[model samples]
Target: MTRKLEGQITIITGGARGIGRGIAKRLAADGAQVIIWDIRPEYFDSVAAGFEPIDTMAVDVADPESVATAAQTVLTTYGAPSIVVNNAGINGPVVPVTDYDFETWRRVIQVNLDSVFLVSRAFVPAMVEKSYGRIVTVASIAGKEGVPGIAAYASAKAGAIGFTKSLAKELVTSGVTVNAVAPVMVETELLEQMTAEHIAASKAKIPMQRLLGIEELAAVVAFAASPECSCTTGFVFDASGGRATY
Candidate 1:
């Protein structure tokens, strides 16, 4: 009777709530020691309540120094993480690219795209040295189809997907795996970024004709972040409800 991720050290960013929290719960339930990294400390109390042996760190994943400090703490406290999930992201305001606020666009890219780069770069070397790791990033279908209004969000996720592929190749022979999950409209707090009309239109385009459930998404991510995910790297697994898969 062995759990798949027993004793593995896992880091889950944006794990305080929503999809990230779901992934943390799944990993912890499977015997992994979970560390939740997020921008808000308040959510940590609520997040820590549902699980045992889970710790939280207030981290600004978009900042290099913050990520570096957190990385050091992780290395010192529990050694290198065996699994890293770059799941923190934001869906910026739904607005046409032509009229989108410049600063907002940059902020979106920094958080959604740059944070993945910063967080992974900080811990990947350690993972390589250990010669065992799983990196799962959350991209979006908007990245594939350029979902009109949310150009910044789409562009950042596209960068995330590309980053995952390139990083996967870099560590392909290092016994580390990197993959991205491209999800369609997911039912989470992130949806608040969209208008009612936007949400409805997005849902209409899904082949499943509905938003993806958080638990369902968590299952796919958990599989991608496990030791059992031995043969897949540099690939994007589709969780878009058939919205777009190639």
Candidate 2:
């Protein structure tokens, strides 16, 4: 059988590393033209080296102008992407809401919540015109449930879920699908910020008692961004290792 996304163009935000990197590589391996949009230019060369045939660009998803410029450059260069994965995010400082630094909270919301808005606003217009597109935002189980500390991160991700649902409904008649992926604590660079006790405790909550692998998460993402995903929209595919049972 032929590859599912052969010849399709996909733009992945924060594709330099972690789950985003896995999604990019998996999509490319499945024959999509992958464009990685990451803020750290220094990492591009290295990330590009890992995915030999993929493309890269510096994009600050939190900034509307930056996102617009990057989308334009991609369209001018590779045409409008059929698939967009809003996977950029950050785990803000771990603290109670009352003790949280306002700056850190704002930054978390900006990167996690505002960036999704910027990227979608900048690029979805073309998708709308074409009447075809796939949008998958990386959310978290924390979004569905309130976790102590990391108030901004959790709230932003929750907002992303809502955004996906609302947009999916709006575009239902069109050929566009919007969805989200909600994973539990995966063993990624982001986990380094959590205290050892917290990490262990979090792990204990999962019935599987293990952290999800990037490849595992990538598989879920690949399906959502594929043409095969026609029937599902505004849904959250869970990769929580049984940690989140809703």
Candidate that scores best on lDDT: 1
Give residue 73's error in model 2 in angstroms: 1.0
Encode model 2's per-residue lDDT on 82-119: one tens digit a residue: 99999999988778999998988889999998998888
Compute the lDDT of residue 177 as modeled in candidate 2: 92
Question: How much is 45 displaced in model 2, in angstroms?
Answer: 5.5
Which stretches of candidate 2 lie above 4 Å from their native place? 45-50
Per-candidate local distance difference test: 0.89, 0.87
In model 2, what is the error at residue 143, expressed in angstroms? 0.2
lDDT of 2 at 27: 88
How far off is residue 242 in model 1, in Å?
1.6
Backbone clash pairs in model 1 (N, Cα, C under 3 Å; residues 3+ apart or in different chains), count: 0
Candidate 2: Cα lDDT at 179: 92
Per-candidate TM-score against the hidden true structure: 0.96, 0.95
